[model samples]
Target: MTQESSRTPPVQDQAAPVSGEGAQAFTRAQVEELFLNAAREGDADLLTRFLAAGMDPNLRAEKGYTPLILATYNGHAQAAAVLLAHGAQPDLQDEKGATALAGVAFKGDVALARQLLDAGASVDVPNAVGRTPLMFAVMFGREPMARLLLEAGASPTLRDGEGLSAVDLAQRQGNTALAQDIRHAAQG
Candidate 1:
């Protein structure tokens, strides 16, 4: 059969094209290791110095975890906040598609989750299995995070690849109360 008329798909003429290579070039393993160390140690001054020296605030390790993610995971809230102020992509996902918000949510750190949210993380960005931050919060029975995500406009009805919604995940995790709360938020 004759091929359909050859036509280029419409490119979204929106934001400027991101220079992936240029961005990736600045993110070296050595810098990431140092940054992660500083974050783990909660050395805000050192972390700031490194960022000032042109080290990417969102540099990801081979495991796909970013500095912001590691900082929050390690309970370095201030460091994570500093990184956000330095242009770190709060929504940057690891190799497993887990964003900083998802990481903090799993840890039940409501404050860090809020920081990531305020930093402009997308509440709807799903992980590799389609689990959003809200899903993680609900699954972990983090009531505060669930409420925060709801207040931040997270959709409780959003489903993962397996058709599991946030409420469903909460129920599966034996959190009936959270499932009810999510349902209410979704309705609102």
Candidate 2:
């Protein structure tokens, strides 16, 4: 396979290459953990290699964090891009039901969030707590992230499980200016 090939068979569809004839077989869980670790460490090359080797790009860790989620949480844009190119599902939620977009929002990473959006990630998918990416941004005082999410069509009127909108969360967090800005954007 060429170095640029992004799509590959799922891990179960292919046999992992062994270094030698007598080498012990690696379980699927071990491979998944390796993939997740590579994502968390920002090792784009390792991710590429894994994908090339037919390891599933969408594998989740013990906490249900996909490679894309781990990469975004660690600010590894390159790794994220690699995962996306390899068909990683950006909307898959972790244990907390937080998508990769939410991770970027918490990190205040507009660029990473943009990458996810461009790859068809939903801007309005909420976590287990019903907190959308916009709410996460607002709660964390991530103005740029909130702005980007708004521009990408995040619903400002959507409320969390607690029935608090992003603007309300912003206000509760003492971000008056950002709350006003979000309110205006929501209204406009």
Candidate 3:
């Protein structure tokens, strides 16, 4: 058995005292703030320790952004990975219906976007305005992010509330190359 397995105690204790507080729990808002800070600071070690200490991995901020979403938005790939491993839902959306993938795409962080996708983030999840990650990437002129989202199964043909597809948004932004790429993805 590995060291970690060896440290596992046999299930015999009837009632071991809970390590931290017993019945008195912090309010959901306070817990959310703590997790949000951990995510925003990119403190993977602190986040992991918090999770290990019985903190909920799915805790969300006031705006409905979970720790995983905030971590990805802040470019904390390691924190995001740790959260995912600890049962953070990759497809959870914020108040605006924007997923972590969409946040990373808007920031033009192709690597982070790839990481989110690999962690099971939805490429086609639409925001409040029916804008997918691809649409956000195109609208923001993030060509690299747009290409990455396309490769990861984002549909260029999906239209937003404005009746504009990702390609259309790219064209509106005057990004001809990105528009071309979106068109090619739609063709495929």
Give each model a TM-score: 0.80, 0.85, 0.83
Residue 98, model 1, lDDT: 92
Instruction: Show model 3 residue runs off by greater than 4 Å.
Output: 1-31
State the lDDT of candidate 1 residue by residue for 70-176, as single tens digits: 88888888898788889989888999999888888888888888888888889888998999988888877788988888999999999998999998898898888
| Model 2, global lDDT | 0.86
Which regions of candidate 2 are displaced past 4 Å? 1-25
- Candidate models: Cα lDDT each: 0.78, 0.86, 0.80
Better of 1 and 2 by lDDT: 2
**Highest TM-score: which candidate?**
2
Per residue, candidate 3 scores C-alpha lDDT tens digits across 1-188 of: 44533222122223332234333234445544666798888889878867886778887677888898889889998998899999988888899999888898889999888887887788899999999988888888888888888888888898989898887888889998888887887787
Order of the predicted models by lDDT, top scorer first: 2, 3, 1
lDDT at 105, model 3: 86
The stretch of ten residues in a row with the least summed lDDT in candidate 1 is 1-10
Where does the lowest 10-residue lDDT sum fall in candidate 2? 5-14
Residues 122-154, candidate 2, lDDT per residue (tens digit)? 999999989999999998888999999999999
